[model samples]
Target chain A: MSSNKQNEIALAAVKLFEQKGYRATSVQDIADAVGLQKGSLYHYIASKEDLLMQIAHQAILQFNEQLEEILAKEDTARGKLEQMIRTHLIMSIDNLETTTVLWREAFSLGEGPQEVIQGMTDKYLNLVADILRSGTETGEFNVTHPRITALAILGACNWVYRWYHPSGTLTAEEIADIFSKLFLDGLLAH
Target chain B: MSSNKQNEIALAAVKLFEQKGYRATSVQDIADAVGLQKGSLYHYIASKEDLLMQIAHQAILQFNEQLEEILAKEDTARGKLEQMIRTHLIMSIDNLETTTVLWREAFSLGEGPQEVIQGMTDKYLNLVADILRSGTETGEFNVTHPRITALAILGACNWVYRWYHPSGTLTAEEIADIFSKLFLDGLLAH
Candidate 1:
C-alpha cells in the first residue's frame, strides 16, 4: 500500500509537471492531485525536488534497461541500432509525460540528483557509441566517429517526442522504420 | 537610442532566461542586469512576456533568414542540405543562449505569441521539406517522407546546443561535416 501510494503521487506529479512547468507546481498542488493533505504528502516524499528526482530516475532507468536488452542481443550493429530506435520511439510515446518531465525539469534538480541523471545519460550515450565502435571494427558499419554518430542517432530518435501525436497519420512503429532506414541507408538514391 | 536599450534588455533577458529559466526570471532581474531602474525598463518593453516574445521572434527570424539564404543558392539538393547543416550548426553554437531560451520558454507565451512562434516554426520545417522533395524528384535523394526526414536532420542539428562547448575537441564545422556525411552517405559501407 505504501509503495502504491508513492507511485500514485509520482504519477500525479508527472502530470502536473507536464501541464504546469515544474517551478510553477507546488507541493500542495501535487498533494491535492493525489488526495493527500499537504503535510501528509511529506510522508511519501521528502520534498518537491525529491519527486522530480524520482520521476527522472525512473525515466532514465527505463531507457537504460531497454538499451541494455538491445545491447545484449547477438545481432549486428545495424540490427541493434534499428531495434534501439524502435524501442526508444515506443518508449517515448508510451511515457510521454515522464519523458517530458525528465528532459524539461531534470535541470531544476539539485546538484546530487542532477549528477545522477547526467551519469545515466552519459551511460546511455556511451553504450550507443560502443555499438558503433564494434560495428566499425567488424566492418558492419562505416562510422568514423562513433560518439558523434551515436549522438546524431539518439538526437533523431529523441526528437520524436516533440512532434509525435496519437492522431498522426503514422504509428510509432512506422515512424521508427522510416527513421531506421534513413539512418542506415544514405539519402542518396544509390 | 531607445532601440538600443531594447536590444540590450533582450540580450540580458536571454542570458537570464538561459541561466534562471523563463518563469524563474523576474522583471527586476532583467532590469538589474541591464542597469536600469525597474520602472524605466517598461519604456523599452511591456512585460516579461514581451521580452520572451522578442527573444523567440529574434531567434526564429535569424534561423529563417539563414535558411532562406541557403534555399536561394544555385546548388544541388545535396549541396544545399550540406550548407544548411553547416550554417545551422554555426548559428546554433553562436546563439546558444537564444536557441536555448527559444526552445525552453516559447511554450510559456500567451496564445497569440504562441501561435506566431508555431507558425514560424512550421515555415522553417516546410522550407526544409521543400529541399528534400526537390532532391527526391531529381533522383538525388531517396527520402520517402520529406517532412519526417527534414525533422530528423533538424533534430540532429538543434541538439548541438545540449552538448557543444568551446573547449570540446571537435569544432562546429567538423561536427557539421560529419552530420552531412552521415545523412548523405549513411552508416553503411558503400
Candidate 2:
C-alpha cells in the first residue's frame, strides 16, 4: 500500500477506535468506514493491533516533538513551563483524535505496546517534573511534591480532549492562557 | 425482583462494565459474571440502558448530596470554595468505580440517559461556577471568565480517577488539599 493509503487507514482506524472503542471495533468496520475491502486493509496494515500501535507511536512522536521544541526555546523555567502547558493544550485540541486514541487506548495495548507508550508518557511526564523542580529551585513555583503536581497539571491539560469542542466558546489560546495562569500564577490577583 | 437483588445486579454489572467497557459488556455478560442465567437477568432491569442509567443516577445523586452539604455549610466564599474543592476531590476518589463508570459509560447510556447524565453534570458544574462567581463578586478570587475557569478547574479535579490509586502515597485529603492549593493559590510562592 502507498504511504498515503496507510495513513488513511490509520486515521480512520483511530477515529473508529475512539468512537466505538478498540475491542468493539473490527477491521471490517474500519475498512467499510474507509471505503476499502477488509482484505485491502491488510495490504495497508498488518492487523488491527498494528493499526492502533502505529497511531499510538505517531501520537507519542508528535508529543515528543512538541515537548522538544518548547524546551529548546531560549526561556526561563517559568517560560518553558507555560509554553509546555500552552503547546500541550493546543496540540490536544488540534489533534483530538490522536489525543483521544493515546489516552483511551492505553489499557488496550498489550505489554509490548504498553511499554512503548509508557516510556513516552514517562518521558513527557518527567519533562514536566524537571521544570517543576527548576521552578522550585528558582523560587517561582511552590508545591509539596513536584512529581505528583506535574502529573496533576498534565492530567488537567490532557483530559481536555474528552470534553473540549473546537467550535465551543473558548478558543485554544484562551484556554492555554487560563491554564498557564491557573497553574503558574493561580487565581489570586497579587 | 427485590430492590436488593436489583442492586446486586447493578453492582455486578458495574464490575463487568468497568472491566470490559459498556459496549462490550452485555446483560448476558453481567448475568454470567454474577452467576445468573441470561433470562433471569432481566427480572431486575429492563435493559442494558436501564442498568447504566441506574448507575449514572446513583453516582450523580451522591455528588449532588455532597454539593448540598457543602453549600449548607456556613462559610465565606473562600471557605466554601475550598470545601467544595475538597469535597469534590474526596467524592471522586471515594467513589472511584461508579465515577469511572459515570465517565466511561456515558456513551452507552444512549440519548435519554445521556441527557440525564448531562443534566446532573451541568448542575454539578454550575455549582462550581456559582462558587467562582461569588468569590469574584466578593473579591475573594480573581479570574477573567468564571464559567470557563470553572470548567478548567473541574476538569482538572474530575479526571483524577484516571490515575489516582488509593494505595498510592497521597491520601484523598492530601490530594484535595494539594489540588486546592495548586488551583487557588497556584504554584507561585509569596
Candidate 3:
C-alpha cells in the first residue's frame, strides 16, 4: 500500500475514534472506512494503537511547530503567549477532528504511545511555562506560579475543542483575542 | 437495593471508567468491582450507561449546588468567581476519579444521558457567565463577550481534572487561589 493510503486510513480512524470511543472501534471498522479488507489493513499500519500514535505524533508536530515559530519572534512574553493562544485556537477550529481525537483518546493508547504523546504534550506545555517564566524574569508578569499559570492558559485553550462551533459567529481569531486578554489582563478592570 | 448501594456502584463505575475507557469497561467489571454478580447489579442500575449518567448527574449536582451557594453570597462578581474557582479545585482534587471519568467519558454516554449531562454542564457554565455579566454591568469588567470569558474560566478549572495529583506540592486550595487571582486580576500588574 502507498503512504497516501496510510494517511487516508489514519484520518478515517480518527473520525471513528472520535465518534465511538477508541476501545469500541475495531480494526474491521477502520478497514471498511478505508475500503480495505481486514487482513490488508495491516499491510499499511501495524495496529489500531499504532495509528492512534501516528495521529498524536502528526498533531503534536503541528502544535510544536506553531509554538516554536511564535517563541522565535522578538516579542514580549505576553505577546508570545497571545500568539500561542491564537495558534491553538486556529488549530482547534481548523483541525477539529484531530484535536478532538488527540484529547479524547489520549489515555486509551498504550504506555509507549502514551509516553510519546506525553513528550510532545510536555514540550508544548513547557513552551507556555517558559513564556510565563520570561514574563516573571522581565517584570512583565507577577504570577505566583508560572507552571500553574501556563497550565491554566493551555487548559482554557484546549477546552475550546469541547464547545467551539465551526459555523458559529466568532471566528477563531476573535476567540483567540478573547482568551489572550482574559489570561494576560483578566476580566476585571482596576 | 438501597440508595447507598446504588451510590457505591456508581462510584465503582466511575473508577472503572477512569482506569479503562468507558467502552472497554464491561458491566460485569463494574459488578465485580462492587462485589456483586452481573445479575444482581441490574437491581441497582438500569445499565452501564445509566450508571455513568448517574455519576455525571451526581458530580454536576455538586457543582450546581456549589455555584448556587457562591452566587447567593453578598460577594462581588470577583468574589463569586473566586468562590466558584475554589469550589471546582476542591472538587477536582477530592473527587479525582469521578472528575476524570466525567470529562474523559462524557462522549461515551448515550444521547439521552448526554443531554442530561449537557443540561447540568450548561447550568454550571451559565453561572460563570452570570458572574462575568455582573462584573460588566457593575462597570467592574470590560469583557465584550461575557459568555466567552466565562467559558475560558471554566475551561481552566475543568481542565484541572486531567493533571491534578493529591500528593502534589500544591493543595487544592492553593491551586484554587492561584486560579482565582489569575482569572479575577490576571498576571499583569500596575
Candidate 4:
C-alpha cells in the first residue's frame, strides 16, 4: 500500500476504535471503512494495538507541543494560564476524535503505555502547577494549595471534550476568558 | 420479588456494569453475579435499561439529599461552598460504582429516563449557581457571569469522579477543603 493509503487506513481505524470502541471494532471493519481488504491492510500496521498506540502517541505529542508553546510565550503567569486554556480548547475542538480516545482509553494502555501516558499527564499537570505556583509567589493570587488548584483547573479544562460542540455558542476565546476571570478573582465580592 | 431483593439485584448490576460496560454487560451476567438464575432475574427488573435507570435514580437522589442538607445549614456562602465540596467528595467516594455509571452512561439514557436525569442534573447545577449568586449579592463574591462560572466550577468538581480514589493519600475532608479554598480564593498569594 502507498504511504498515503496507509495513513488513511490508520486514521479511519482510529476514528472507528475511538467511537465504536476497541473491542467492538474489528480489523475488517477498519478495512471496509478505508476501502481495502483486511489482508492488504496488514501491509500498513501490525495489529489493532499498533493503531491505538500510533493514535495515542500522536495525540500526546500534539498536547505536549501546545503546552510548550503556551509556556514559551513571553507573558505573565496569568497570560500563560489564559493561553493554555485557549489552546487546550482549540486543540480539543480540532482533534476531538483523538482527544476522546485519549480520555476514554488511557487506562487501557497496559502498564508501559499507562506509564508513558501518566508521564505525559504529570508533565501537563506540572506545567499548570508551575503557573499556579508562580502566580502565588508574585502576590497576584491567593490560593491555599497550588497543586490541588492546578489539578482542578486542568480537570475543568480537559473536560471540555465531553461537552464541547464545534458550532456551539461559546467560542474558545470566550471560554478561556470566562474561566480565567472565574478562577482568578472568584465569585464572592470582597 | 421483595423490595430488598430487587435492590440487591440492582446493586450487583451496577458493579458489573461499571467494571465492564452497558453494552458488553448482559442480563445473565448480572443475574449470575447476584446468584440468581437468568430467567429468575426478570422477577426483579424488566431489562438492562431498567437496571440502569434505577441505579442512576438512586445515585441522584442520594446526591440531592446531600445538597439539600448542606443548603439547609445556617451558614454563609463560603460555608455553603465548603459543604458542597465536602459532600460531593464523600458522595463520590461512597458511591463510586453509581457515580461511574452516572458519568459514563448519562448520554445514553433513553428519553423518558433522560429527561428525569437531566432534570436532576439541572437542579444540581442550579444549586451551585444559586450559592455563587447569593455570595455575589451579599458582597462576598466577585463573579461576573454566574452561569458560566458555575459550569466551570461544577466541571472541576465533576471531573474528580474520573480519577479520584478514596484510599489514596488525601482524605475526603482534606480534598473538599482544598477544593473550596482553591476555587474561592484562587492560586495567587497577596
Task: State residue A67's C-alpha deviation in candidate 4, in Å.
Answer: 1.3
Clashing pairs in 3: none
Question: How many clashing pairs per prediction, in order?
Answer: 0, 0, 0, 12
Q: Score residue B159 of candidate 3 by CA lDDT.
A: 92
Q: What does DockQ come to for candidate 2? A: 0.63
For candidate 3, lDDT tens digit of each residue in B1-190?
6989887888788888899878889999998998999999999899888877788788888989988988888988877878889888898789988888788887888898898888989888888888888789998887789889889988898999887877789999999988988887788865
Per-residue error at A172 for model 2, in Å? 0.7
- Expressed as tens digits, the lDDT of each residue in B1-190 for candidate 4 is 5998897898898888787766568898998888999888998898888889888888888888889998988999878887888888788867888888887665456789978987897798789889888988888888776766777877787777776776678877887888787777665453
lDDT of 4 at A178: 81
Model 2: CAPRI class: medium
Please provide, for model 4 over A85-129, each residue's C-alpha lDDT reduced to its tens digit, 9 standing for 90 to 100.
888877876888888777765554567876787788778888888
Looking at model 2 chain A, report the run of 10 residues with the lowest lDDT sum: A101-110
Ranking by DockQ: 3, 1, 2, 4
Among incorrect, acceptable, medium and high, the docking class of model 4 is medium
Candidate whose DockQ is highest: 3
Q: Which 10-residue span in candidate 2 chain B carries the lowest summed lDDT?
A: B103-112
**Residue A98's C-alpha lDDT in candidate 1?**
88
Can you give the lDDT of residue A42 in candidate 3?
91
Which residue ranges in model 2 land beyond 4 Å of their true spot? none
So what's the TM-score on candidate 2? 0.94
Chain B TM-score of candidate number 2: 0.95
